[model samples]
Target: MTTFRKIAALAVAAVMTISMGACGNTGSSAADTQDLVVARSLETTDMLPQTGFSNGDIWAIQQVYQTLTRNKTDGSGVEPGLATSWKQSKDGLSWTFNLRRGVKFHNGRTMTAKDVKFSLDFARTARDDKPWQFLFTAIRNVEIVDDYTVRLDLNEPWAPLPSDLSMSASSIMPADFGGKTETEFRNNPVGTGPYKLGEWKKGDYIKFVRNPDYWETGKPKLNSVTFKYVSDANTRSQMVQSGQAQIDEFPTAVSVSSLKKTRNVHVESFPSTSLIWVNLNNRRKPLNDVHVRRAMAYAIDKEAIVRAIYYGQAEKANSMLSKNLMGYSKDVKDLEYDMAKAKEELAKSSAPKHFSLTVQVQSGDPEKSMLAQILQESWKELGIDVQLQTLDSTTVYSNRTAGDFDVAMFEMTNDISDPDEWMQYMFSSSANVNSGYRNEKVDALIKRAAADSNQANRLKDYAEVQQIIADEAPEIPLVYKPGLFAVRDQVKDFTVTTLGEYKLADTTIARE
Candidate 1:
């Protein structure tokens, strides 16, 4: 067992007929070497590391980009990536990093302090409207101290800065964008990671070949990787079973037991800081009313969603934050599943009866659609006509950010293991997530927690924040869930960081 498994307050380790093997090349790659095929639930929305919004895009970015600091392989802490070492000031307002020399981007250009400064500065001020802007918002400036050294000047003592820097959003890109136009660079980005883009067909598949000049030696043991767009979870499962794809990510949680029964298939279920929820457009309509929001929350049966969707894999969520997160208060309870209470609350609201509204789901995501249907059926009982709108993941994310939908479904994952990762984006008035779920008290509390160095003080503030959110009902958090992935037995040394980072550098495929 890894250290994180033992120490993580919220992680459960469940494994059957699976063990992580040491990564080693099984054979030399000829043209005949089989590429590892992976099937996922959605087509990648964007290839650029910092801007990609979909799970498909994130999966691809993990393969092609490197951040300055990465989550430790065993879990829950930061480790070096592009930077060999870093030193933080006692005041936490400034930090210096010594970058690894000789590291080359896929374009064969060596990574330098200039690129680091540009990437950090760009991410900090790029687009205030983007959800990830919070990652770098505290950085006052980035200074290129020397050829392989850079320093970050902060506006405040940001404790999450190290973890934030490890995210794909913080990945360093070529300062010159490889001398390509922004549009061209976005379409074909280069990084100092183990894989380089081989081919990308929009709405179809993405191919990544091993980077010949990767800084890490004896890495990316496989010749290449193919991530095929298979939106349906069942088909993704079938693809893995039939050897069409060696791995399937986000395989329906309920199908895991059955999938594990198939020959040579292994199911990996591990703890994660994921909160599945229905995000109400608090800026719109009756949803703006706390009564209506709480009404919808009470109507939905969280237990049924767990049983039907997660099988035996999940626990009903208590509050917006997952149980694993710090300051997850046991006292802040979820609204019980009470249809009658739902009616009372609905009746109390201005849009009492025969009111119609829509809830949007990601078109091909089984979980989102099923969860929406569940909401659709129950919200109807309140005399609320619910319209089900199914859109692609890209549009779903765009609509949410633009506040263009009545309601939306999303399985929110923390980019880092910090409570503020979700707290700021989901509840803070300053966040551009478009939730419109604002409380000046919450805004004040979050502001205090972000700057406070003492965990004790932060925890007290966050607890109050959670209770306030529970009462307000901005989002109906359904479950505190686990991460699920189906892999071929031949794929060896398969492991993800506690933060759910798919670090493939040490992974290899075994011989038949």
Candidate 2:
């Protein structure tokens, strides 16, 4: 940083420090309300859960809708939600779920087998903007066994189905949607969860009210839950400290320490299936060669970045799979940060030492920006000129999908709580073909693991696949960022799942 830029940053920090004292707190009027507010960096215009994987959308929809299966609040595993019990066939082609009786939607309609089949059918057939359709693509048919039972017939044996059903995409809704059209239903959606949609101010905030006729007995402790949208991570942490929001969703990893030091604020972190990485386009020059990719990986320091950028909130990752993930292996050996190793690998590459390359990052991601700067300085030792280009999410994703850059920054999060749903995008030859990465061995292992019904065999396949991916080095892993949050001191019993789910059913606010 230049002297002038350093001075400007110090000035801004000074102003923020002074303002923190003047901000509100848990004792302030904002915290005195009966409702609990969660501050997030994004907003969801799409209220439907099956459409896209938005963190804010999942947090909101989970409060209003219940899926056939649900993640245990204590992070144990999948458990009964609307479905009282479920079992798969010995041949692994069919999955049968028994629904809970006397369950009611927000509109006072009782749930039945028809609702279960209808909801699954709605998710299976994608109409528009349904990125999670891949989760249900295996299902060829949905059959209503009885008024209280439903069965799903799959074209292939998809081992991820059971865990995938725990995602927000598999949420059960009223069969007729409470007599509302698509637009009308979106505006006033009804569900069988503990909360009801109250008001949604686009790009601003979404509010949910406690359901009076909820199936869960004596739950949803808060009178209302409001999700306030603030696009900056630093600002979200500040909001929690100021009591503007009782819970701050995924506060900046670098800012976790300072927020925890505050008297009225508490910082919480949990193991998560989130991996931040840089995909090296295997088809692009200077990055296409395995030696070049290996050299780049060795040259980049993940430990320094994770410590300085993520503070202590995350850990340096050796591979694409997070340690918290089910199929993660401790034996996969990837290139660690070593200047000597980098020089050794580069000597065998086409670029060898001197080459100017560009990496694309999404604008407004503070971590990515810091990471780019770190890369610019570190790779200079290897005679590499690193060029950074910041663009909007739409442009960044489009470029990534088109394989238009030498290197690109992105994060992979598991919404389904299963490794197959997230790992395939990184290593599977047929999946994410734009990455220009392919290996028959890795592809076969991924296929075997994804189709096998036996957990031990699946784990063995994934373990081998992870090693192959690390050795190939198509993508470089940076950090395994956990599900992090900042909350006011008064908020208690908030559980953070491996999938980063906001399990609010068990949360409680201190009355005192």
Which candidate leads the pack in lDDT?
1
lDDT to native, each model = 0.78, 0.77
Q: Compare the candidates by TM-score and give the number of the best one.
A: 1
lDDT tens digits by residue: candidate 1, 1-512: 12222322111121121112112322222214747877877687687766776566776888888899987754456788899999989988999999999999898889999999878877777674345777777899999999999999999888777778887888899896889977898899898889989999988899889998988888878788888888766677777776777788877665677677777778987677778888889888888999999899899888777766666588999798877665678888778899999999988997888788888888756667667777877887888898998887768877887789998888766666667767887899877385788799998898789888888999899999998898789988888877788887878877765556676777777754
TM-score of 1: 0.90
lDDT of 1 at 417: 62
lDDT of 2 by residue, 248-337 (tens): 777666566577677777778777777888888888787878888888889877876765676566788987887877888988897898
How far does residue 3 in candidate 2 sit from its true spot (Å)?
15
What TM-scores do the predictions have?
0.90, 0.87
How far out, in Å, is residue 67 in model 1? Answer: 1.0
